[model samples]
Target: MKNMRDKNSTNSGFTCANCGRTVSPAAKTARNHCPFCLWSLHVDSVVPGDRAADCRGKMEPVALFQKRDEWTVIHRCEKCGKELPNKCAPDDSFEALLNLTALQQ
Candidate 1:
């Protein structure tokens, strides 16, 4: 059986470590971060949901960026100083996205 941490991964919903929100997985895709606070964990190495990384760092939402007309959130690992870009979910908080985008403007 998978352990508690393994069970509560991107495939399943889990409480957010940054905002303490009860985040649910995306309906049709893997939930990479908390929709409420836009925070993520440093679990994936080369691809999203791969779970091959062992950094276990707290990913902080830093900014909003666009690629091919799609908006993505920039996450920075607090422990390792690595930066990654994640697409915004359908149910992600619009206010949070606006705030991050505004900062860049």
Candidate 2:
């Protein structure tokens, strides 16, 4: 699968499927995950925002990992058990990221 570090699509914000929170667009890139809850959908297969995957499973944020100075969110698909790491957006909740990291300790 092709790994896209930055999502370059311009799409409208979506409501969170996990927490039912209204999520706004990231303003700079495609909002693949909900910033409020840090949850994502299994929509992309090869490239980010490609929407080629048919799993459509609810992706729960399992953990957070850092590469150098950047943080990435690790999501696990509840339906298909697929795991993917997503690049963190600038406005993503810091507290939520902290909580996810705390789980690893």
Candidate 3:
């Protein structure tokens, strides 16, 4: 059997480590970060949902960018300093995204 942490089975709800919010999985995509704080755990090493990483660090949202109409959130691992970008979900907090944008400007 495949592990629950594997790429195909990682779409599950989790509590936000940064904001303490009880987050639900995304409706159309696999939820990887806290929508409220835009924080994530460093669980994937190569690809999103892979769960192959062993660092298990807190990924902090540090930047934001846009490509066409989609917005992406950049997260940096606090423990290892690895950075990754994730696409914004439909339900992600607009206020949090705005804060990131302000910091970039």
Candidate 4:
């Protein structure tokens, strides 16, 4: 049910809107969202690290998780029907996780 890209990232470098940071696709660039903040630019396919889709949808973190020896966050785009799991950075929003849990209940 996940629309994943089979190719590597083709686009690199952008001014991050969340925290005024610059990002570029790199071999070890495992970050999909801003490390300074949880907000992310509209990029990538359903899965992070792949840039094979043309949706150009703004991804917003709706849920957070650090489960089963893994760290992941759930993203949903308002412009598109794409939803997928992305890797969460250590600087991710703890408040966002709380908000998600509160909304779930």
Best by TM-score: 3
Report the Cα lDDT for candidate 1: 0.83
Which segments of candidate 4 are over 4 A away from where they belong?
A: 1-13, 18-29, 95-100
* Candidate with more favorable, higher TM-score: 1 or 2: 1
Q: Give per-residue lDDT, candidate 4, residue 35.
A: 50
For candidate 2, write residues 1-105 as lDDT tens digits: 122223444366777889989887677778789898899989888666787788889999998989999889989999999888889999999999999999999
What is candidate 1's lDDT per residue for 1-105, written digit by digit as tens? 232258346578777889988876689878889999899989888778777778979999898888887889989999999888888888999998898888788
Question: Lowest lDDT 10-mer window, candidate 1?
Answer: 1-10
Q: Report every candidate's CA lDDT.
A: 0.83, 0.83, 0.88, 0.61
Per-prediction RMSD in angstroms?
A: 2.4, 5.5, 2.7, 6.2
lDDT tens per residue, model 3, 1-105: 233345557888888878889888788888889999999999889888778889989999999999999999999999999998888999999999999999999
What TM-score should be assigned to candidate 1? 0.87
What is model 4's C-alpha RMSD? 6.2
Instruction: Give residue 67's lDDT in candidate 2 (0 to 100).
Output: 99
Q: Highest lDDT: give the candidate number.
A: 3
Better of 3 and 4 by TM-score: 3
Candidate numbers sorted by TM-score from highest down: 3, 1, 2, 4
Q: How far is candidate 3 from the true structure (C-alpha RMSD, Å)?
A: 2.7
lDDT of model 1 at position 72: 90
